[model samples]
Target: MDKIKISNLEVFCNHGVFKEENVLGQKFLVSAILYLDTREAGLTDNLEKSIHYGEICKYIENFMKKHTFKLIETAAEKISMNLLLNWDNLEQIDLEIKKPWAPIGIPIENVAVEISRKWHTAYIACGSNIGDKKKHLDDSIYALNQRETCRITKVSDFILTQPYGDVVQDDFLNGCLELKTILNPKELLTCLHEIENAEHRERIVKWGPRTLDLDIIFYDDLILADDDLIIPHIEMHKRDFVLKPLAQIIPYKRNPVNHKMVIEMLYDLQK
Candidate 1:
């Protein structure tokens, strides 16, 4: 909730659409606000507990000088993402990239791009129905933990469950993991897919047999429906395997659409 602000820091970099802009270079001004919890630092009077503004400025300068982009939009996005990845305490960032002396014929003050990015909390249901199920789940957790943008905060005990769909294969070892992530929904989905593929998970049939199954059961309070992904997992409320393990860790987590807690859903499903 607290912020550390850096205002109008100037840098010289090559980032522009025109040919001459890249050849000759130009001046860029950046403004940033990093959101974080500084309470511990304030209470303990420890500099390590807080983000170092000087270090951040140096990082931004280096990043801008090192990379050449055609647009300020790209520069802003890359810088924001880099800052978020480098700083663990940073919860959100408001970044602005200003380009002065534009090639436009008009005498404008400056052209700038401003944007905000933040981390989201998401819950994933993980399962494996074939070939070292426990190993599959453990490896998935280890993979998530290794990511800089994501942290595995908690995991539920695995439960043995019958196959939910018509596929007659093996019972699944299902569980859930709660993650704190800086990755966007789509990025997180991509990471999950990559992890699955690394485990050699074969999707021969829907809900058939898998080496690892990672589903985004909840993403903040978001309600999303897309061709490749669905948020709050469409059938999570009805599946005891999901609700049971979810209840073990996040009993109070609510279904975005139903507005019912996981504990309530699990209880109701029993009858």
Candidate 2:
């Protein structure tokens, strides 16, 4: 990835803990490193193909002036997220804010906060056995799409599937969605739980009936296991419900753990 750097860009904004400081306002030094592919622009020498630094600088100034927060941490977080949300080509950002006029009596050069953030790809499986199954699945998708940090890139058509465990239940509407998120594994799991609970999902019995069920099937080819979560989801390749939808969107996607393509696994399962 190519990089763009903007350093020591000054902005006057009102952000501090003290009431007087907020009212008086202060000068802040902002720096940022934007990560994106610049090969196309380099080859064509076209300004349209790359990020416009001048525009981004003005945007930074406006954004900082538009909002007021007590901590630079919050300011940086909001700025970074907003940049990612508005800019399609930006893949990651490293932002730094320097408070040279901090009210601390102790003599110090400056107080600053720097943070790095990026987007990650994750695949999630959706299932529901009770109530309006299609509505349950649809609502889950809608909720995921509504989250600012998450973007749904693809979705497979819902398929009817028998219950997995021994508990007797009606057929489930199963599907999968390709999600791009800024949240890490644990945070993403938490978001999924929120969506499930919002749809009134119950965990009374193992793999039992529910209004909605959301499971992390994959997280960037990551191989992981813990007391609470597992990745490449245990035995996902063997289950038609999981494999079928996964194959539809990512047939060529390789399982980092199993070392096999999604289509290959689905074919073997079908055979």
Q: Write the per-residue lDDT of candidate 1 for residues 139-248, one digit (tens) a residue.
A: 99999899988988899999999999887899999999899997889999999999999999888898789999999999999999999889989999889999999999
Give the winner by TM-score.
1
Candidate 1: where is the Cα deviation over 4 Å?
Answer: none
Q: In model 2, where do residues sit more than 4 Å from their true spots?
A: 222-227, 235-238, 264-271
Put down candidate 2 lDDT per residue, 1-271, tens digits, no spaces.
Answer: 7999999899999999998778899999999999999999999999888899999899999989998899999999989988988889899999999999999999988899999988889999999989999999999999999999999999999999999979988999999999999998999999999999999988999888999989999999788898889997886987899989989999999999889998999999999
TM-score of 2: 0.88
TM-score of each: 0.93, 0.88
Global lDDT for candidate 2?
0.93
Model 1 clash pairs are none
